[model samples]
Target: MSRQMCERPDCGRGPIDEQGFCDVCDRPPLPAPPRPVPRDGAAVRDGAAEPERTVRAGARVGVAHVRPDPWYGLGLVDADQAPDVPVISSDPVAEAHRFCPDPSCRQPVGRGHGGGPGRTAGFCPHCGTRFDFDRPDGLTIAGRYDVARVVGSGAYGAAYLAHDRNLATQVVLKALHRSVAKTARHERDVLVGLRHDSIVRILGYEPEGPHLVLEYVPGEPLSARDGDRLETLLAHGVRVLQALDYLHARGLLHCDVKPLNIIRFREEGPAGALDRVRLIDFGAVRSHTKDTGPVVAYTRAYAPPETDPEHLRPTPGFDLFGLGMTLREVCRSRWTDPATPGVDSLRLLLDRATDPERPWWRFVSARQFAEQLSGVIRQVVAAAPTCRQVTRPSALFGSMPEPLHGGLGAARPLAHWVAARADESGLLDILAPFSSPEPGDVAAALPAPLSDPDDPGVTGPAGGALAESRLALRRRDAVSAAERLTAAALPDWHWLSDWYRGLVALADGRPERAAEVLNQVRRALPGELIPPLALGLCAELCGDGEVARAHYRMVFDTTPALGAGGFGLARVLLLAGERAKAVEVAEQLAEEFRYEREARVAAVRLRVVVLPGRARPAPTGEDVDRARAALPGLDVDEAAAASLRAEIQYAEFLRTRDRLKLSDAVRALGPHAATEREYVALVDLANRLRPPLGRGRQGRRGRTGRSRFGAASGRLSS
Candidate 1:
């Protein structure tokens, strides 16, 4: 018999030498049949079985009995012994499990119970991680510390007061929220290099799973205390200034320095210890190296005027201004007080501190201010300007005047001495001669008015007449000054002379011409605040509310604490029916001057007027009580008070009615229907309350109608 080679490609055994059989590829030789069906009995022809009813060994019989089965022909004993094969098809469940690749998907496949896909048995459809059906007992950090309490939350992350079992200490763990984990890590790396006593310490850092741990300082914020004594407050201020100076030296600006960020530590050792003050909250700290970026920190009252929308660069000077304001707060014990002196007043007081001609007031600068305070206290409160003056005795005390004494008093002798020196030069020289001089005495010594005042060219006159006229012009006579400048032929005095000329025109009520000149000057000197303020007043007088608003907005926007100036701008906006914008300005002013009654009243009125009806469904009795409490002892103008009362009543009525309707709609239809119906009602109410259309006297009717509607709407909305 011929032998065959192995058919399997991976098999290496060759066919048997003589039989041509490969055990690896060929079927094993079947046991020899008891008797090979006799070829004669089978009558095999061409390797086929004969057509006959035969019952032979290894021969398969069928109902027809005409053909043999393939397996039977292949030497199988019977066809019934053949192996069964399974059919293959696609499975949707398996495909869905593999479809999603995100690991953090909430709806995982096979975890169908809670935000999961049911198709896959144990896999996530959204994020293909295996489903964890059992809820975690609690989230762990650093494989040790467990979350205990949320200390605080901010844009970067949430701070937690967590207890460490290993160290047996309570530390604040500031972990970055998922949104800013990487950024927090980067910030941590940057801040790790900074070391300062005032700065909150970064005990250690663990950048694991978007979390960071920081040492927590336990104390009260400086802002929490009220009615702090000036000496004590000043001492605390010095410490903060030292920290700020250190920060600035290191090329960093602690942009946010409000009272809230200052931490006050209490020690039992001594009553006047200086180390009690500490500055914290470095989240808003910025490196001064960057050229441009949005202001990262803003507290309405504490932020400087330079922080307006238009101002871009943050200068060291800006920080100085904030420090100045903070120091002012410490000294004054209030953010604002109409009774308190203005910046000019404070400056004048400081200037007069040493001059014998003027009465002695309080210390003007921080160091001098600190000297009045105790030593330990002084060390902490002295900031930059004051800190520099600390070591200099002359800077601290040289300017102060000797205390007057005796029953007769030093008034007369001082007056005589001052009179003897009256011949000196300048206003100060003339005024210096009088010790506690009466207003009449100073007026009596003045040079007489010029006889030929109409002559613009004359610089000198007899009997000091020209000097007196010049003084008068400086003190008053804006129009006269303008006329003189207009008539003058001098070339060198154009700009300065023109400025006076513009002032005169404005004072004369010719705002159109004044505006023309002032605008020119403003273009030339953008830093000047007076010209812009004058221009705004001019626009207001000319009945150009929009232009006036724009100018006043610029001024108030730049210098937030300009008192009545800010309120004036807000008034223009309010009259223009720009309630929202007006409210924003008013709120800013109110916060900037929290103690100012007028500012607070204006802000409250604007808020009530502009509040959206939907935002407040119904005003409660408590709301009315609070509003009334804010207005205690305030004697507002009759018109303003009436208008405010009307608005409040209308708001209350509108709110109550709408709330009832909303409740019914919600109960009957559904929450969705109630929302839509409420919106429709509010729109209808707004339309009815809208002011009339037009300008000038014709617009007055519309204005009144709108005001009335607003008043009515407010009551209903409340």
Candidate 2:
């Protein structure tokens, strides 16, 4: 009889299989409950960590049933578009114990080797080693730590949950592979000296044995992080980059930096980005300047193209590449992200990292990489405004802006535009589909609606998405509309969901949220101008004059006659003390919309105004005469035309001493203004100021020249 090798991290000893099951826990696999979206009248989804479906009597679903504990529903979003936290699978990480005792001859021997259920007890077919997975508990080590549970076992080593008596804390003790353990001591010695906020702290070194104690971060790996978002991951990337920068400054490189080695602490916020991150499992740290050994450990998914052990020169560049790979996965988390505007810039960073041989310039240093990732992070934060969101200076755009009460008072227009360009472009035309107000109308005015087709969700069934959402919006049940779109969201067409959510937010009177959602959609699909238009409208409604002005100007500059853009820009300009520019805008609009009634009225009204904060300089003699000449063919009622002309003359009289010739003024005045209210006011004032009215039609009044006070009040009463 030969003893088989048991390779389970916790059960490292082999025992003879008995009673058809291993001595260790051998219960059947727990079925993962299906996560189905609740239908129109179906019961709501359970809010358990691993929620099981509720069963009705005689229901076809005959699996194990469990009622949701009321306590579980705490803080659940409770709406149809509730945040979906993924359930972790219960499947064991490692294969069943069936190999030989000798680690080298780890061959299968049990009956279940292929498919059929095998006798738990077996001898290795190759080396005749008894394959037993049963091992005892309460194992102690080096008279200090007690192994309480098995954490994980991998190609590199085994991790165990243990209690450290000396420190009075729960710690992780890694029992490395015998071969690697022989060399891990030197690595551990150097790791003890390394200290950083983001790097997992090494508690103590068990110098005489294979195990070492490490601070057990109470969190899951990046892959298992609950409710992850692009912003959240980008935050993690920033922290990791900081750690990497610190290590590089000390001349060390993390040869392995993948999602598996990243542990996100539970204390961190999910969305707002004020997060705590820990980089763990430094099994492959080396001196970038001096360490010239073969690559020790690396996951191929994140390792650089040049990581072949035969030529692997571990450098800061290698670790930077690893971080790039890690962040790429982070940005594209399991939670679906329709390729957002930031995706492209992030991809460039990734391409540089995973394959640096092509970039010509050696891949960027960690600090530079952090700067790039910080940009992506800021855009993400700006795109999604959260209650607790931190306002960080954007590396992509610039620094903090000067505070202002109103107006386009701060921020560089061009820099702001370029920074937000990718995100705002695709959303302007987003509402075009809703114009028809019915699902039966058309998909869009154009066949292939200009959008980023390269985005993940655009490839799915596309025709009815916008139409269905639009019709739902027409029903005025914005939440229902949002839910329908969210339910219909496929991985490839996720932007459609965001589109309707934005519309819902806008319709429901949540401009800030609507702006946030639309901005995200803009970033995700940066090929069109719809988002910018929508963003401008949102900013306008939210009273963010600067942002609205910049966005509106962008649209008007590109498409001068896009009615919304022109109107929005004019309003923003009028508020910003740009009276002349506002008049010029109206004039430009009048030219573009020649013969249009609304446009003509707008030009006349906008040409003369005195609002609270904005006091336009009095009209010049030339402007007064020009208005008088252009009044007749202004395309408005005779009364309105005459009123406009007289108003201009009144303004000129008030502001300039330039004398007006009554004869020339009468000649230039449109024929329609004879009985206009403004003309009446103008004539009455001129008569009173004339050299003693001689009982003509104007002799009814005995008023001399009206004082400035009387004149100002008279104008106000009119």
Candidate 3:
């Protein structure tokens, strides 16, 4: 058989290896040449381009939609208006303290001594190295690119604005400095195969000056303008993560991911001008598989502290660390409000992304990073009252079977309607709507964290053991679950093992232990919301209202799609006697799609419910009126509606001690009783609440040993 020639360009017709790589170049063979299609729709030969299909307007490569959440520009205030592009100086002057381009001699050369003006062009005094700061004068690169001026410079090289003579468009000529010349071909190879929208495109490479011809992105660095929303900056961070994901999949790493390498500009969309970001400058690009040597090109400020620039291994974590620092730097100016909805989540995300501790603790994949970042963006956008973000289910956690709304979301029980009792003052106290559910119920109700497909523990016996343990927990067989967890030989540091242990503890009603174990998972996956959510439940169970509040707020403020977080936060806030804040939480939750009805009911209840003897202040007249007005229009069953009305009327009765309000409350409870016996009991309670025929409005103020529904209650018991 004839030896196949490698199809890679400029490979000098190298033989193709069994691995489909060029033997001479050690790179994957380039894709087959595109065949040309006749303009008249006639097929001439096999070496022709495929017929183009009609793609939709918003079509994209790889995935239909890369970003799950639509970009909300500047907190919904300037979403329709694109950010103004910074005007680039065509003829820019070099900085005064310009350094030598040589890597070995980076001493400042252009600085003025005493009163003399700095020389724009000179030799470095310290190392006798030639340095030039003068703008390119009539410089034409590769006969096709006309160099204009130096746009920017970095550790690897200086980028110049140049015009492509044949293409009639502007391009960037990244002239590699002499020190980084060896990486020029590597950077070229990395850029040639990249075709992501957020990634800058490569046109051609010239070997004479060793320059990379790149698509010119006319924009400023990823930055915060005045009035820029923090969400906008985070949105750009998410896009960078997407681009990083693409690069990492191809075994390439953009080792230097900084704000200057990301270009932000405006792109006209169907709605309006949209803010867009592009990842540029692949000078630091290296193959994670092949380039396992010393780490050379990285900004110290953005690089991981644990990594030595001279000898760090090539891992996705290195790039992720740089991205985290870049986002932190760019978002610092816009993160003015510490109380901003997604701020806490964003902080947690960056913390996990750039964790200086064990390498495994940081974000492992770009998709994982993007998932949390996108969620944070949703929260920041939804925090604005004028903005309504579309709710999407969590990819990390399964859907919750219960709303965990507690008493606020449900009607009063049949017994509550049938066996109501009056206090020593001949008045009945209204049941608080914001009562938290039993801790055990919350522990059971929280959605389980989904197994990560990328996790090694997700396969073989470890995965089977986990599934079996979860099934046992679901069956309420804590012993069996615990046994399975103990028997399984999982690694000590495996997060899945800790997660199952927490669940087992929770199932066994050991919330304190569960809290401890779940907190470990939180440390393991700081970007995830489930750990904090479970911790919130554990805290609530332990009656640590403040701790629960903090944990719930972390999850809920990040993404209301996790409805359990919202309900838990509201319940904790209610228990803390912060009624207004609790009601606000519920009202905000009502704005989200899937939890709308439950949250609406909770909001109504929160405005009026008062826990007996808890020192919780009674609802105001405005609160009562709003609750009453909202109750009738609520989308609930007749019994639930009646129960809600009864609660509202009972609240009014307690406030004013009005017989009419008390009677309305009693009448409203009729529909609440499911059985005839319960109905009769409710009627008896209503009769007992009535005013005495010969007594004043206050009646005889005295303690009664007999409960109001004592006879009916005894009858029902019999």
Over 333-407, each residue of candidate 3 has an lDDT whose tens digit, in order, gives 766676766676677778877767666667777876776676666656666653545444444444564777766
Instruction: After superposing candidate 1 on the true structure, give the runs of residues whose Cα lies further than 4 Å from its correct spot.
Output: 1-139, 178-183, 224-227, 267-277, 290-301, 305-311, 320-718
**Over the stretch 142-250, how does candidate 2's per-residue lDDT look in tens digits?**
7778766566655555576779888888898766545677457856876799888889888887743466778987666665245555555666676787788788888
TM-score (C-alpha, index-matched) for candidate 3:
0.73
Q: What is the C-alpha RMSD of each candidate to the true structure, in Å?
A: 47.1, 26.6, 13.3
As a TM-score, model 2 comes out at 0.43
Q: Against the true structure, whose TM-score is highest?
A: 3
Superior by TM-score: candidate 2 or candidate 3: 3
User: Which residue pairs of candidate 3 clash?
Assistant: 35-47, 35-48, 35-49, 36-48, 36-49
What would the TM-scores of all predictions be?
Answer: 0.33, 0.43, 0.73
- Candidate 3's displacement at residue 447, Å, is 1.5
Error of 2 at 356 (Å): 5.9
Candidate 1 similarity to native, TM-score: 0.33
The CA root-mean-square deviation of candidate 3, after full C-alpha superposition on the true structure, stands at: 13.3
Question: If candidate 1 were superposed on the true structure by all CA atoms, what would the RMSD be?
Answer: 47.1
CA shift of 280, model 1, Å: 3.0
How do the residues 1-718 of candidate 1 rate in per-residue lDDT, one tens digit apiece?
5564544456674562211123453221222233224423343545675532222211210011111111110111111211122121222322222222232443323424567555433555444455322221243567666655554544454466667767778776765544555556655664686676666666566656455666666655564244343334544555565566566666777666766667666433333323355665566666666636866564545655543431256544344445545665545533243322122223222232222231112122222222222222222222222231122111100111111111011111222211221111101111211122121222222112111111224322121232222233434555444445544433332233344445556545466786787675444333223445556666766778888776676556445544334655766776576656765676666655332455666655544432323442234455555555655444564434433443444444444433332222212211111244443443333333332234112322311112212332222211
What is candidate 1's CA lDDT for residue 504? 55
